[model samples]
Target chain A: SQQGEEDPQALSIQEGENATMNCSYKTSINNLQWYRQNSGRGLVHLILIRSNEREKHSGRLRVTLDTSKKSSSLLITASRAADTASYFCARSPSGNTPLVFGKGTRLSVIA
Target chain B: DVKVTQSSRYLVKRTGEKVFLECVQDMDHENMFWYRQDPGLGLRLIYFSYDVKMKEKGDIPEGYSVSREKKERFSLILESASTNQTSMYLCASSLLGGTNEKLFFGSGTQLSVL
Candidate 1:
């Protein structure tokens, strides 16, 4: 069974709009990573947030971790048409364990 | 930059036929993984290897097997392909034993089983 589950399976917005996606996990994790997949293809790593950290930023990507709530969110600021893709959240339990992925949220940014 | 390459971009085979998906990494990373991606199901781990000749089953390992003859290569094999087995297969590699290790992935192979 998948340990992580993402909410809002799909989202659509204008190119300049901001998009946010949320994910919830069932277990404690060492880290949570976000990935982007274009047209249901291979995934590209976006950002990773450690369990102890409340938030992180990488370019236009921002990720927040609320361990007390077992939840996390990814916010893409000033979305671009190129940003249209599926986003997934993967959790690594403890250390050195394979990541467990959520179903994912598909974001479509219209230009 | 790390490069994880899959042998084919697409593959088609009849039911009950043997199928093999190959992955190679140029970064000399110690860990490699194979996963299948399906619509609404996300990516599910089929197998992974930490070193040469070492293999471990992931969440979904049924009807699947893996071979890691060398550290740079990992292969996923299906003894008999089934219609339900048709999906996008992805390969990834990362540094060994890091809590915050990020996975580098290949472009993926879309396999179709008739």
Candidate 2:
């Protein structure tokens, strides 16, 4: 079963606009990571926020984790056409367990 | 550069036929995984191996099996292919014992079951 559930199944925005995606999981996690997948391709790791860390940033990507609410959010600033892809959030329950991925959010950045 | 290579970019197999998808990672990572990507379902783990000759079933392992005879190689087998099993298969590898280690993924294999 999937541990995380991503909100806003699809999002459309202009190239210069910002995009936000949210994820909610059932159980506690050691960390949360976000990934992006282009059409017909594999996933690429974006950023990871540990349970202890409230927020993290990589380039224009920002990730925030809230353990109390068991949820996380990803924000992509200044979206571009190349940024159009499916974004997923994965949760690791512990160091020994494999990461469980959410369904994902499809983001379309119009040029 | 870290690389995970899938043997095939595209494949077509008839229903009930046996199919094998191979993956090799050059990073010498201790963990390997097989996942299937569908249109609306995102990615679902099929199987994973933490070490050579060790395997574990994931959430959707039915009708599928895996083999990991070597540390850097993982093979996903479809015992009997079905139309419903047609999807994009991805292979990934990661180091062990890290709470937030990033996974390196292959380009993916698009399999079609007729």
Candidate 3:
């Protein structure tokens, strides 16, 4: 079974608008990572948040993790048409375990 | 820069025929993984290797096997291809023993079984 479930399976917004996607997991994790995939290509690592950390930022990307709720959210501010892609949330139970990815949320930023 | 490469961009094989999907990583990472992506099912792990010649079964390993004879190369084998087994196969590698390390993925191989 997949450890994480991402909400809003799909989202669409205009350029310059903010986009947010949420993920909920089933068990304890050492860390959570987010990835972005363009059509017909490999996934690109976006950011990772450790269990002890509440939030992280990378450029226009912001991620928040709430261990108490076993959930995380990825926010992309001032979205652009080039930001259109599929976003996935992956969870690692521990340092030794491989990541288990959710189905993903598809975001389309219209120009 | 880390680069993971899958040998094929697309493959087609008939039912009952054996198939092989190869992946190679340039970063010499200690952990390598194989996953199959299906619509609505996400990416399901088929196998992984933490070291050369070592293999571990993952979430969905039926009808599939893996090999990692060298540190930089990993191979996934389908004993006998079936139509139901068709999907996009992805390969990834990550540094060992890092709690928050991110995986580097290959471009993926789309396999079709007739």
Candidate 4:
């Protein structure tokens, strides 16, 4: 069971700044997903980038996957104060199995 | 919209007591999972069920058991609650088939064992 490991345990930035979080996994994957959790709340799915895809965008969120490196990066552009949350990356392995999540990076967006 | 719901948002139980955490999904998802989130441990899978009366142990299945008697409902039972088991419990559901599908998570249950 391989799990995605996100870098930078915690990050803080001002409003309107861009925030980037990276994730790395050990094995082959079908897809990678990014989720955001507000304080004391369940995680909400943000975006998913397939293994073959290089980059994807949804609103202010952008995800890039590099299968060669087994790494993925999630970029939230023009971060808002409301964007303060814990962002996690999960990887779907090659088979029909559960997605494995990382410890996540706590992002604090200051106004 | 797909929704996964946990029966309780918070629970408090004494050590040695039996604890039951229930979850239900509105969508007829074929897969259901139970995960515990801790401060530094991230989200560790406790158990997963792909069908009724079917279950699979996950990374940290110790002291945890699951029942999936119904298609939409799954239960995580703590035979004997322990202090170390106090953590946020999350239930998630996903459609069957490709592994690339997204998972829908519940609001979560914060269980406190005294």
Q: Write model 2 residue lDDT over A1-111, tens digit each, in one string.
A: 655999999999999999999999988888899999998888999988888999999999999999999999999999999999999999988657788889899999999
Candidate maximizing DockQ:
4
lDDT of each residue in B1-114, candidate 2, tens digit only: 889999999999999999999999999899999999887787888998888999999889999999999999999999999999999999999996542578899999999999
Q: Which ranges of candidate 4 are over 4 A from the true structure?
A: none
Q: Give the poorly placed runs of model 3, Cα more than 4 Å off.
A: B98-100
Candidate 4, residue A47: the lDDT equals 94
**Tens-place lDDT digits, model 3, residues B7-85:** 9999999999999999999997989999999888888999999899999899999999999999999999999999999
Model 4 is docked with a DockQ of 0.78
lDDT of 4 at A32: 92
Compute each candidate's TM-score over C-alphas. 0.97, 0.96, 0.97, 0.98
Task: Give the winner by lDDT: 2 or 4.
Answer: 4
lDDT of 2: 0.92
Instruction: Tell how far residue B84 is off in model 2, in angstroms.
Output: 1.6
lDDT of each: 0.92, 0.92, 0.93, 0.93
Worst-scoring 10-residue span by lDDT in model 3 chain B = B93-102
Model 1, residue A40: C-alpha shift (Å) = 3.8
lDDT of 4 by residue, A70-93 (tens): 999999999999999999999999
DockQ of each: 0.71, 0.63, 0.69, 0.78
- Candidate 3 TM-score on chain B: 0.96
Model 2 TM-score on a 0 to 1 scale: 0.96
Off by over 4 Å in 1: none
TM-scores of chain A, one for each prediction: 0.95, 0.96, 0.97, 0.98
